[model samples]
Target: MRATMMDELHKPYVDTARSKGLPTYKVILKYPVRHAVTPLASTIGWQLPNLVSGSAIVAIVLSLPTTGPYLLQALQGQYMYLAGTFLMMLAVLTIIGTLLSDIILALLDPRIRLS
Candidate 1:
């Protein structure tokens, strides 16, 4: 798998980081989530659908006061365009997020930078 190979290539940096008492996984975990707080892990975790689902639930709760119903109605009314826009946005976000993850991973692991 690509991840496995990347990890192997980065093993030296991982070992170095661990030797220095850093959470070496930070270099590898970014591929799946994103959080501005811990940019690396957060960015990698951002890609997992579970994070999106959690956000949606929070949004729904927050929207219960004023905007949720109206937005739901609008989306239901414009089903076709909504679907198209959602798909396009999803693809774009996915690509951009992955690239950000790769860049962060490479920066964290010097072995990756040499390549």
Candidate 2:
């Protein structure tokens, strides 16, 4: 059902819609076609490069503090790997920051994600 809905949203729709006499972008835009974008983003959140995306993965990784030198420092406390952890956290935080960015983009443009 979702795939069908998305197929209808695009122009040409894999070049098949044209053969069936479906409206292209010109006709669709003129007809004021609009759809909500939030739910789709919400659905895509799991695999996206943001906090909600793969957070489960990170959480599992972080739970084990004594794994890698990088993850070791990231836990908390002045262990011998403090520097390594700090840098590791910096990288991880930067990667996680994309979550905020995804949120901001979604907010700024309700139509950021297509139907």
Candidate 3:
């Protein structure tokens, strides 16, 4: 991620900022880092579900009583209602997180918009 953002920072727009007499830190922050934040924000938003699901595996290993392990158990047992509810919770969280990231990115980067 840092490498990708560094590549973005090296683009011509950052040079333009440098040529316009912007200081090194200011130029880097205002130009490239600003652009880099969008994808990072979106990635973080999408990864929320992974964090939730990953913890389930950890909970199982640690013998912790968490929803993730129980959710997995429910699915394995063919408990449709319980499984569906857990799935719905995950789906809603994912959608909401993405929506929030999109809104924030749209606000920060005028080149993109949410219709």
Candidate 4:
């Protein structure tokens, strides 16, 4: 991702920053790093749900009291309503994670909100 970000940066932007007497660190931060943050946040945001929920297989195998085992049991018992509710809850959490990522992105670069 860092390599891709570096490749995407416009040379003119770097040149302009350098011409303004910005040090290398400042120039990189103002140009490439800042611009890269949005996509990074987006990737992290989508993965946040999984991180928080943990691996269902691991949870079930370990007999943890988290949602995974309950969801599995609901499905196995043919309890459609309960299974659906659990699925919905998971979906909501994913949406919340994505929204959090967007908020972080906006905070990191206020220009995003303006556009």
Candidate 5:
């Protein structure tokens, strides 16, 4: 995120905003920060699945009474229906996360259109 912001700071539009005599804070917020956040919003969608998977692994390793261990057991036991349901849930979650990110990206960056 920091790297993105730093890169955005050097973009031509930011320079143009500065040259136009916009206030420093307004220039930074309206141009560079807005542009930098688009990447961060997109990344949040991808991170959702990673967070779930990481937590599942942690839950299993810690022997927590959670669905993570149950999911593993279901897979190992050949419980096809249960395993399929769990996978479907994960897919749904991924889709929802992506949808949310798309909405946020659209809101933050005028270049993105939902249609």
Candidate 6:
């Protein structure tokens, strides 16, 4: 976010907005901040899978009653149907996350079109 904002702040459009006498807060929020959010939105989409995978380890270590441990148990026991269901759920969740991010990106930036 910091890097993206820094890059955005230097762009000519931001400079143009500043030159137009917009207040600092308005200029920053209306320009660089809007552009800077794109990367963060995309990062959120990418993190969904990681979050689910990480939860499995965390659940095992903490001895929690959750889907993560159940998934691991199913896979270890060669329960193909149960294991496949879990895997399918993860895949669907990842696809949803990606689709949502694309929609959000399209809304945030004029250059992106859902087409």
Best by TM-score: 6
- Which candidate would rank higher by lDDT, 4 or 5? 5
List runs of model 2 lying over 4 Å from the truth. Answer: 1-80
TM-score per candidate, chains pooled? 0.43, 0.28, 0.81, 0.75, 0.84, 0.86
Q: Which ten residues in a row have the lowest lDDT in candidate 2?
A: 29-38
- Model 3 off-target regions past 4 Å? none
Each model's Cα RMSD: 9.0, 8.8, 2.1, 2.7, 2.0, 1.8
Q: Kindly report the root-mean-square deviation of model 5 from the true structure over all alpha carbons.
A: 2.0
What is candidate 1's lDDT per residue for 25-110, written digit by digit as tens?
67445432222223443368347433332344456768643333444554778877665655565567677677776777666554
Clashes of each: 14, 1, 0, 0, 0, 0
lDDT of 2 by residue, 1-115 (tens): 3563465456453355456666567544332233333345444534333332234346566763333434434454556476565556556665555575567556646666456
Order of the predicted models by TM-score, top scorer first:
6, 5, 3, 4, 1, 2
Q: lDDT tens digits, residues 12-48, model 6? A: 9988998999999999998898799998887787778
Q: If ranked by lDDT, best first, what sequence of candidates would result?
A: 6, 5, 3, 4, 1, 2
Best of the two (4, 6) by lDDT: 6
Give the per-residue lDDT of model 4 (tens digit) for 17-109. 888998988888777786777788878877866765677899999988887888889999999999999888778888988899888888877
lDDT of 5 by residue, 31-109 (tens): 8888888878997987776566556788998998767888899999999999899888778879989999999998999
- lDDT, model 6, position 108: 84
Residue 84, model 3: lDDT of 95
lDDT of 6 at 73: 98
Tens digits of per-residue lDDT for model 3, 25-89:
99877777768787787777788777666688789889887788989899899999999998898
Top-lDDT candidate index: 6
Off by over 4 Å in 4: 8-10, 57-66
Q: Clash number for model 5?
A: 0
After superposing candidate 6 on the true structure, give the runs of residues whose Cα lies further than 4 Å from its correct spot.
50-54
